[model samples]
Target: MWIHKSRNPNQNFKRGGCMFSIFLWEEKDVQRGLFKMTCFSAVEPKQLGVILKDMQRIKDGYAWFLDGCVFCIQPFQNQSRYSLKGYRIFFNTSIETGMYLYDITLGLLGGQISGIECVIKCPSKKSSDWISGLRSDTSFQMTDPRGLFNKNGCGIIVVNDTVILQMRNRNKLKVYEALKKIDSIREELLSSVEYDLFSCSKEAG
Candidate 1:
């Protein structure tokens, strides 16, 4: 969507009002090691030892919240260029707290709503590369290496059948309760007085 605002002007271009809204949908990386950051990031770790014992579960070199579910984390190395590592989760059920991942590959248990589909390169001390996305139970398609899948498919980066499934299934209220802390940030912009509607009206009168 292009906006035109020129009278033999500066390249005959200007940003429209809606372009500012695009930032709301921008994908932001929420790595685990950067823990005090992004209160908006969500994850349902399958490591009970981390949640129950008040410990941190490290995956792909980052810390994630553990409730109770089973998942697997493997170093993603498929393409000829990048040797990135990622993990996949098989949810028995979903609590729907809205998780964020680089790309989530699901099994028969749970799924994602609208999540980040790209993978991230994490150079941390716990895990290699990390992938995160939204957590919803919609039964999306994951990549089937066997080439025996239906219409609804998901693309997965399988290294070995070494896909270690992990878990942290927990109370739904608790997850949502924690997420409430994350708030939407608002931004403001300014325009010159020459374009001010109020000033223009006053000057014309």
Candidate 2:
């Protein structure tokens, strides 16, 4: 829970909906608790070094390991043409560590990165059934402009024993709130399910 009082007293923050814009604030603005805008530019090696330093500063005991890179592609309409849409860097981290790392990574790389998706492991539950229920439920209807949702019409995807959540919001504050909402939804959905003691014990060990 990263909490910050807004500098604008009149700004009313509304709950629900996914119409958040990119917010790029300077260090001074951060000190003043104000949101600012950022421009999209090519990421340099020095900038990446700075991001690593920043990550080290707040990482605590959490670690974000590089998993792999995915090549993103876009196909042209009614033509045999395709465009390369940059590469997506994948990272592996524990669920507890992922919560904050997701937000921090987005904040640091939002200007250069177009989108971020979190793949949560749901080993105890059937991901297909869970995602189907979420899609059929009216409460989880999230309009996505990126066309990243599955055929079920939600910002969620089921892949084997994992559930992928597409997080499109670039603002760190909005991302934090969304994460809290996601946790609440997860609890509500899994309330009836029995706790996986074996999994807990394995993690603890």
**Candidate 2 segments exceeding 4 Å error:** 1-42, 50-114, 132-138, 141-154, 169-173, 190-205
What TM-score should be assigned to candidate 2? Answer: 0.37
lDDT of 2 by residue, 12-124 (tens): 22111321111211222211111111123244323454554533211111123232211111111123224321223333333244434544653355433334444444435
10 residues in a row with least lDDT, candidate 2: 69-78
Residue 100 of model 2, lDDT score = 44
Candidates' lDDT values, in order?
0.22, 0.36
Q: Could you tell me the C-alpha RMSD of candidate 2 in Å?
A: 15.8
User: Judged by lDDT, which candidate is best?
Assistant: 2
> Can you write out model 1's per-residue Cα lDDT over 34-120, one digit (the tens) per residue?
011111112243332343232223332222233322122222222223322223321111223223321222221132222212121
Top candidate, metric TM-score: 2
